[model samples]
Target: MSAEPLVADHAHEVSDHGHDPHATTTGLSHIKLAMWVFLGSECLLFGGLISTYLLYKTRGNGRTLPTDVFDIPFTSVSSFVLLMSSLTMVLALSAVSRGEAEAGRTWLLATALLGGVFVGGQVYEFTAFVREGVAFTTNPASSAFFTLTGFHGVHVSLGIVMLMSLFVASVKGKLTQRNAETVEIVGLYWHFVDIVWIFIFTVIYLIPAD
Candidate 1:
């Protein structure tokens, strides 16, 4: 009986039906861990930036302040567009989860396009400000405003690159059963960018500066 059981175990191992109990972790699990660590560090970075912006928001010197220069209605629309892009990003992840690669790619492209539009709007707004005499070095208010919002734009641009890459990979069949987690990771990053914009919009546009 002992010999029979041993033979059965050996047969199972030889069959390809058994998994490796001691296999090393790879793929999505590793990606999630790295993202968690990166996000934690980013929290500190954004927190310090927010604190500095608030501290120097209104220096004693006359400055091109947010209150004076911000176009509330236009920025409000841009902010809404960014927030909606987060929804599209989630839908992209959902499409991947459902194994609908084409749908996922479509949604990813949409999200990236929306991000591009948002960034373009930001560029236009900045250019308008410059045209209206609000250079970054012209005042502490302008400096803080541009630094905080400009950093957020940089993040959005990075997210766009990641989204476009994912879309291309999906088209090429590189993203498959082995890589849906890549989509989830990108979704997390895209969502973070959207949430950060929410805070930036509130601080830079809605809040009353002292």
Candidate 2:
């Protein structure tokens, strides 16, 4: 019944309902839940693409298949760069939550730059594959391969855009501690993209081609 306890309760209540514009009755942010649902749907989509690729991977019309043209070492480096971006994303969220605006923006920019590098690497890899006689229209296998990886690259590109948006917001002094949840939401998307790439890399690159 102390004034201090009452003040603490009021602060907590304000923190919940005041900061989040998308709060639900269950105290969860509806926006966050929606993001989770979206990601779940994306999983099914990627699953279908991966399954199709697997089915047609070796059916290359006796031409160059994905495995024949993969530059594993180069892709491995790109994958590492993308995974490192996830770490930078974590740092961004941490900095924003602590109200370190400058550090948060720095991390956000770093994450976006890393994503750009990954996407660039993917483009280079695709061009290299085409040079090696494996192209999107070269065979069913190539078509599926390009479709799957291309979708992922697009997702990464979108995530980079989101990160850069946050950076711009920070620069304009619009992003702050209250925007921490927004950063976390973007992090969810970026991490999801990165995780999907891991699966794609393991399936298409690491797995031995018989």
Candidate 3:
């Protein structure tokens, strides 16, 4: 009945029942789970955009259709550049996983540069379209096309920003193997963006317009 004995008994009971609060029951990090959910939502968004583009692609009246204006060879080159960025992204993640911060930063910068190149090509294409009177208001097809592709460009630009931020973090000694999951998450996003472009290129560019 002594106070010291009661306190010691409570301490033992608590120690026996305690668990690690930071441990995940599913064996997956919360950040990764959240990223998967976000990617799922993005899939729905891109799906709707692609469907809209397909639905309205034939609605242009006396306006420039995709067949008339699409520069397939140029776009193919840009697509290849973006595709290569995915490779660099994987390399970045691998370097980070191995605690090679300098190499990871280099690969991240490479990926960002490739993404920038792709965006530059998109800008050029958009400029040429406007110059040729294929403005967003030209027709339904033009509107849908611009919206779909523009959204994708925005995603790529955001991805580039993230890559550059990661590079800076690596340079500052903030990124390491301990937090390599961050790089993996960003790589997931970058790969998703590239895959979406593949679909867009095939459905909007490679396929013939009716």
Candidate 4:
């Protein structure tokens, strides 16, 4: 028996209850599907970066590797903060799903704050690296290192912007249980960025540079 009618009935009921429904005949919503595709492409992009970094990190060609000046303890704390933001994102989605707009906004803001802290840490680390003479043009290793980590910092910064947007929407009374899917989509992106950082922190920071 086709379950299309059942899903259609459920969607109708949700709509009548003042929820968005965000219904589609297709199993997956178009936006969500597109996000998955974008993330897939992103994986390939990061893969190339990591491979390039690994290739050149061991071949500094007389220039000091950026990894040589890494502050592992500081970055470990930053990584922890970013990972915690993913948890806050989940809480935000859960709150929105349950129609707790105030709680949702609180978690959303918290997540954004965590992300901001991580980015701030990255900026400080980059400054310290430059002070230690690890300029991007100093060597191939430094170029690859900056390129990979800089791209990740950009992604995290964008995720913070998205979370702030959701928080603003809640404050403006435009976000409710009906908009849960929106929070979920943002959460998906935020979690992906955090997960990517785990791989980055492991390979770029934890691995021995020598």
Candidate whose lDDT is highest = 2
| Candidate 4 lDDT, 1-210, residue by residue in tens | 324323442344434434444456564666677778899998998899999999988767897888789999999999999989999999999999999999999999999999999999999998899989898888999999999999999999999999999999999999989788889889999999998999999988997876
Q: Compared with the true structure, what per-residue lDDT tens digits does model 2 show for residues 1-210? A: 213312222233344325543334555665677889999999999999999999999998989888887898999999999999999999999999999999999999999999999999999999999988999999999999999999999999999999999999999999989879889999999999999988998988899978
lDDT of 3 at 176: 85
Candidate 3 has what TM-score? 0.89
Give the lDDT ranking, best first. 2, 3, 4, 1
Every candidate's lDDT = 0.80, 0.89, 0.88, 0.87
Model 3: lowest-lDDT 10 consecutive positions: 1-10
Q: List the residue pairs that clash in candidate 4.
A: none
List the candidate 4 regions with Cα displacement exceeding 4 Å. 1-25
For model 1, what is the error of residue 169's alpha carbon versus the real structure, in angstroms, after optimal superposition? 0.9
Please give me the total number of clashing residue pairs in predicted model 4: 0
Residue 109 in model 4: lDDT: 97
Q: Of 1 and 2, which scores higher on TM-score?
A: 2
- 1 against 4, candidate with superior TM-score: 4
TM-score computed on alpha carbons, candidate 1: 0.85
What are the per-residue Cα lDDT tens digits for candidate 3 across 77-125?
9999999999999999999999988889999999999999999999999
Q: Model 2: how far is 138 from its true place, Å?
A: 0.3
